[model samples]
Target: MTTYTLNVVIDNKQLLLLKENCYTLCIAKKVRDQLGDKYNVVWKGTADFTQNNQFKWAEQYEVFALKSFKIGALVEAASKKEPIGHKQECIFNDSGVMEHAKADPNLGDDTFKVTNQYGATSFGISTILNGEHNTSYISPVIIKGHVVFAPVNDIRVWFALKLPTGTMFSDFTGEYVELQFGGDKTTVTVCYDDLGSWKLKDSNPGVVG
Candidate 1:
């Protein structure tokens, strides 16, 4: 038998309201009713390793189960750039609706550590409340080293860049391609005076369209 917990966050105010047995989806919807529709609900729980008395905690996993709620109180407060009901929102680059959220200390989930400690990151907010483990080290601490942001897996996405007319190319993502005199697709080297359409480079293996 698997047990579950319902987690909700109202801007910065977080609540793990469900205590009794209930459908996880139903609990998520309830929080959504009171909070609007912007907040995310992250579910955390333990898994049964065996039918015996022993269980597993080492193989723990954090799943993004559901996201259904909004804290109107929090959002309204953030626009003024102030703490809203014990939560603070920090927006970077002076843009992006997505803001980094910090929970109020008074709420008492040990999230207060983030407020006092600078240069350290919060390990896991939900993990702290669940009592699954201790020591809140949110973000990885960097100590004087070359930081590399390498993708764990190959990513496929569209790339659109303006190129100068007659510009020569060398290599990209370990692949190489050269542009021709020009037909339809925009040339790699030269920027066109007129609006040009984009097409896949010929050297791109297995990419046709």
Candidate 2:
């Protein structure tokens, strides 16, 4: 299991619902330092996929409990020889990611960033995410990590991976749901491949930048 370390800064705010447990977090293989820096990331499966088509997102049964949730483990990661990223709006409110990665070759990285939880800069404001889960295609995959939701936080934010129905859970999972970001929607799908690469798709109609 290739341990995948990611710095999730709520890549988008339109998916974060702290009180509602609705979030969409994503991770890429490479981060650019300039406009033309090459970048890439492996795509993999996760512990938060949709059931049939009813939105089986990875929600914590209890946020403040002792029970823990398990996501998939990372397999591998590398930098791709692709063009740098474009200027996109960052949004992270009702969004949030996991697990074994599968390589799908090295592709270009075209992603945006936003956070309503207040910017990390001294010149930014702390915003809040109020958008609904109307996304079309958005899924994140990482590797090997353990985290507890509720029963551990003393709040209703239960972790430990639970399907929307509170039936089954896994070390890592995947989800296929659309989010209502501002006024757009896309069929987001995240997962890991068998070749040890991570996969992420923001296939919304002009949704993801």
Candidate 3:
């Protein structure tokens, strides 16, 4: 069977700085500079994505940054409460998913920064399919507590890789693709079934299995 893997890689240099002094604003700035401005590195603590799609618990001492992309317009529209007409629904089902998938071959590994109902910045993956977009699973790598207060000071990152359900191996142009995040790299193995439902596969920190 062909297997699909999704991997998350963290930048060690920046991670090291945070590990040295997670709470120090100066060190946080240095880390952010090294990681680039696009990432969501904050001096204040950040919230992790939850199953119920809520961000809770505000604590000091941990610092993190993330790079995320915006969801496609059609996918976004389908997700909202606004009424969708039959013609729009048909177009969405027939072409919406594939268009989004092809638009971003890196979709599996990239982070999508989404705002929840409460206006908190939550990290999660959005599905390309009509209803599935709302159900996409997101797992984030988080660093907790200050270096002084926390026993472990490690950087953990997680991203989701998804293919439209029933996508066959033959559907892709290549058997494998390599993805680079800063100085780190990861591989993803994908599997297919007749049901055509997207599958969520988790990978090791740097390796996908």
User: Across residues 1-209, which tens digit of lDDT does each residue of candidate 3 receive?
Assistant: 11112322224443344335432111001111112322112211222222212111111111111222133111112222222111121011222121111122322232211212222122222222212212122112221210111111111122222222211111112122222222232233222212322222434232212
| Model 3 residue 66 distance off true place after TM-score fit, in angstroms | 19
Question: Which model is ahead, 2 or 3, in terms of TM-score?
Answer: 2
lDDT of each: 0.19, 0.21, 0.21
Candidates in order: C-alpha RMSD to true structure: 24.4, 19.2, 20.3
Arranged by lDDT with the best first, the candidates are 2, 3, 1
Q: Write the per-residue lDDT of candidate 2 for residues 62-166, one digit (tens) a residue.
A: 011111212232222111111112222222222221111222223222332222222221001111111222111111212112111111100011112222322
lDDT of 1: 0.19
Q: Model 1 misses residue 115 by how many Å? A: 17
Candidate 3 local Cα displacement, residue 137, angstroms = 2.3
